[model samples]
Target: MNNFSSPKIILLEGIVNESGSLHFFEYSEALPFSIKRSFWITEVPQGGKRGVHAHKKETQVLVALKGSVKVSLEGTSGSKHEFILDQPNKALILPAMFWSEVTFDKDTVLLVLSDQEFLESDYIRDKNEFDEY
Candidate 1:
């Protein structure tokens, strides 16, 4: 297991503990970065997937509020890691240039907090293009 500390990998636990319920905590004061946008996924049926790209400027913290999901991360150095997120209070902070994909199991709720506004140009949709960066 790799300890979360890098420009790419940031693991934050207990980010949603204050609300007393996993379904309620949208934001928390314990987060180091300010939230610019908030979103959630509630329709991820089993075998469904989301996120298959990397951001150029946006940084995100992904939390599994309900059920379970798997996050696959590919780094600039060709290193790859997979994290299983099942708890609401924990989060995986993904930085720019790291490609990530999320696959959900059953009725999973994946909440994301972003650091930048939405920009189409900032997104790298091709793995080969992202690897060249």
Candidate 2:
């Protein structure tokens, strides 16, 4: 659906096909950009906060494959929103220039699909710097 293009934070649909013990998530066009890199976050300590930053020019889709996680996003104008993702098919599309903080539950497994490759310079880690950037 590319909800990001329409000023939406999330896409409500995805394909879930389970065969025996394998489950597959198919996101054909739910996201605005094609994923160029994929990674998963695991072993996060309880009540841990990850991704306290904003991307300069990148997009990501976050999914909680195992357990629930809270994603809080801060807009450039200081607006904030939070989403709890507990399902694998429900993906949150976080656009660039939005500061995000992820709170993970115990035994949570978060899967990330990104449009761009890793570049340390692309991240704005400090809130003060993010506001100015």
Candidate 3:
């Protein structure tokens, strides 16, 4: 665990046209795991925040679909990382057991895809609880 590191950010190039822009990601090359579920967080207040837990057995990739978000990651090895998702094409990968916190910019739209389905037992809601895992 001492060697834990935040997964590298994956940048998905988008094609822009007169009508709109298109973006896509493939699990085989863009993500380390297949996406089993997906969710989004939106309409966050100017200073609002979310996510202060670590997953027990799920991996996630997060993207800012409309606005910007700041993500903080804490590893079991006591390593810390912070990333800003300001563009729709950029993403952050969070593997299992990585503690994460999110601070959203006003009206931010964040999308997250999980490698596993919703499972209460797969979440560590408390920092101390996560540390003990």
> In candidate 2, what are the lDDT values of residues 7-34, reduced to their tens digit?
2445455444564233354555555466
After superposing candidate 3 on the true structure, give the runs of residues whose Cα lies further than 4 Å from its correct spot: 1-5
Which RMSD does model 2 reach against the true structure?
3.2
Residue 99 in model 3: shift from native, Å? 0.9
TM-score of candidate 1 to 2 decimals:
0.79
**Each model's total of backbone clashes:** 0, 0, 0
lDDT of each: 0.76, 0.79, 0.84
Give stretches of model 1 more than 4 Å off.
1-30
Pick the TM-score winner. 3
TM-scores for all candidates?
0.79, 0.83, 0.90
After aligning candidate 2 to the native by TM-score, how far in Å is the CA of 69 from where it should be?
0.5
Q: Arrange candidates, best TM-score first.
A: 3, 2, 1
Residue runs of model 2 more than 4 Å from their true location after superposition: 1-27
Over 56-98, each residue of candidate 3 has an lDDT whose tens digit, in order, gives 7788889999889889998988888899999999988888888
